[model samples]
Target: MIEKQSLPSAPILIESIRSIGYSFETAIADLIDNSISAKATRIDILSIPNEEPYIIIFDNGNGMNKVELEEAMRLGSKNPNEVREENDLGRFGLGLKSASLSQCRNLTVVSKKDGKLSAFSWNLDYVIERNSWSILEYSEEEIMQLENIELFKDVETGTYVLLKKFDKIQASTLEINKTITEKMSSTIDHLALVFHRYLDDGVEIYVNNRKIESIDPFLTKNKATQAKRTQEIKIGESIIKVKPYILPHYNKLSEDDLKKVGGKEDLRKNQGFYIYRNKRLIIWGTWFRLSRQDELSKLARVMVEIPNSLDDVWGIDIKKSTANIPDIIKKNLYSCIEESVFTSKEVYRYRGRKENNSEKYNYVWDRIKTRDGYEYRINRDLPQIQLLSKNFDKDVLIEFERLLKNIEKSFPTNTVYLDVADGKLKNDSEMSAEEIDELIMAFEDSLNKCQELGLNVIEFYEQIIKTEPYCNNEKLKELMKEKIKKYE
Candidate 1:
């Protein structure tokens, strides 16, 4: 028979778990996950940055009883392999302990339920001093002595997690208030982004008495944002939703609008795939190595929504900060990349027409590279250009052709290429509500002209629907159908 040996000392094991990689922001986020899983509608974080700073997070969640509280403090409280509730945001069960202990030496959790309060704590200093695994149960009087513990005095049910002796966050010799203020800014932004969907659904998060607001990366509410048709992919029992968005041209956005979607990073760097697990953003700003990041595709962002059930399929990690897109979805996404990229380029190329008086040009100029170097050619068959050419005299036409050739020769192809490669290309576009309205108005006028020319309504509909601008709009096609039926 083999004899079982006890694990390492309690202090050694506890300290080891604390060393797991968790930044100040991520650690707080992990605690917030617990608050959410507890069905908390309101979460308040209070950090007092004195010499002996304490970070307190209190949530109006389903507070645990004495039995449940003890169980919750146990290491590996729940198996990662075990099935969990659909809304539960935890895995490995070590987040509460490891995340809290990473920054502080003492972690105290106080709960109020059924008009009674219970408090418990895990102190690394106590463990090291006693050399034993033990939990320190606090008396109601003792708990009340702690700063901000009075918050739960009158509440019916809620949980408060207090982190004391913030060694990691206060490591620097800098002034405590300044350090805390600087870190709070990033923490606020991260919490707003990670819990954006929750915030939208009416969950309130307050830090230092200030409420946190959600920042929508999709810009879905903006009238100028272009949405591609949604696609769905199945991975076993789970269905992953995919929706692509082309953000409005920068020129159309005010300064405040820019900061709301872009945050502190340049909007270009914030592009690519945004993975949301249960409507909370986890992995983002990546293409999963399927394609390179291009300036042209900066306006292109793909939203991939996955339920918590697919956590294993997507390789969700302990921190829940990163994930891998499954192989099955990769093929479909790659196949659609070309079309998405083309739409993105069109958004980039169409820049200056947002202004009311700006002249709109729809010239498609192809730049070709041969062994001799580069050449540019305008598509002379374009309807607008062809119509203009009919009004030119012979000598005037010769001069026009010479001018087009001169413009092509001076195209600055290499300069443009280098600028795009260096991420210096200005991402402004001519697309706006005005442009779409003008397009529809022009199509309606053209239909009236064709009617006066004695063209058959059906023939006119068939030809016009296949032409520029009209072909791009499905609603316009339906409108044309209505007009043709009215005329008949």
Candidate 2:
């Protein structure tokens, strides 16, 4: 018996995987990968805003021939593991199709190579309706028209991709254009950072006519800052380098300045471990649970570089924009992440009032005499107290007397003795004085101790005296009155 092999079904939209789930940023990154693979020295991303604003990515590279262009349209056609030139940035070949289709319904690629030009278009709606792998071939007139397009006019050899029918662009009514510009600006800044060496080598990237600038995630531009430290581990034949970074303290960054460092406020966005495949960024967040401490959030810009060979090890997906860090990497990452967290915490240790030694304690001393001149006096000794009365206002004196009576009732003399025996008094009170002279001397000594310990002392005495605490014993009243009279 003879058996027939069935042909593969035409590609269909996986109803489970709606195109909306893929962010516009990821789609753009995927298109840029193709540009890099074509050996494009210069790339221009133009955003045309009309009824249907389209995105155009033009690159001056070794353009594709008719056959190559046809093959490129086929999804999942290229071998991901095949070795290519060092500069090639393609892997799994699905990026062009997946990335483009994920954003818009129409994707058109026009190219010129070896004096011949060709074009191809894939419309998701057309494909879904026809249920076939049909592409629009470039007619002579169409090819001629595309040649005059400004993006390709001066190019000796290159390719251009136009994404139209943008169904995926975010629609926010508040400053929509400004929002898009800011997002693209930040995305380009990051892309440039990821490919700084490439851009430095005479390759230019422009976003809406403005040149994209490279921003070092490590802030290496500051000559005084320490250089980023790198740790490398061998996963099979490929060497994965983890560059850990400790950002400057919060106070060191100015308000307007931190805003320039995209997503600086969010801890999740701040400390990042960018994953690169084939010299292109595949991931730009944390490596799962490798680092999740609140303190480590500030050091959120660390990047991890992985060669293309280890894409499988990293579980890189077809879109080349997301990946899973393997157990091998996870194990190595734990130590590197812990060390980074420790360093970041140490740097920001003095962040708030925790470092203010002077305000740690405040003491206030007040001496007052009554109008009757009965000679009764009051001496208050407390640690870290803020004195509310200097002249001893009647209302403040009443509140003080109420607080003292409450303390005496709730915490009797026996309780105080127990507290002192248990060492709790060390935290609650200063030294105790029995006789009136002794109490005065002790209060002065405690004030000196507070000063010695670098505490704030606010003295409020000899301002005003109204009534004095009544004591039955004549001897005690005389001593108190004498002390009050001396201070007054």
Q: Kindly give the stretch of ten consecutive residues in candidate 1 with the minimal lDDT sum.
A: 353-362
**How do the residues 98-175 of candidate 2 rate in per-residue lDDT, one tens digit apiece?**
778876778889887887778898877777777777788888678667522666668878988988775545444345
Candidate 2's displacement at residue 240, Å, is 1.1
Estimated TM-score for each candidate: 0.74, 0.66
Q: Residue 325 in candidate 1 has what lDDT?
A: 76
With candidate 1 superimposed using the best TM-score fit, by how many Å does residue 452's alpha carbon deviate from the native? 24
Q: What is the lDDT of residue 143 in candidate 2?
A: 68
Best prediction by lDDT: 1
How many clashes (backbone N, Cα, C below 3 Å) per candidate? 3, 7
The C-alpha RMSD of each candidate to the native structure, in angstroms, is: 13.5, 14.8
Measured by TM-score, the strongest candidate is 1
RMSD of 2: 14.8
Cα lDDT, model 2, residue 94: 74
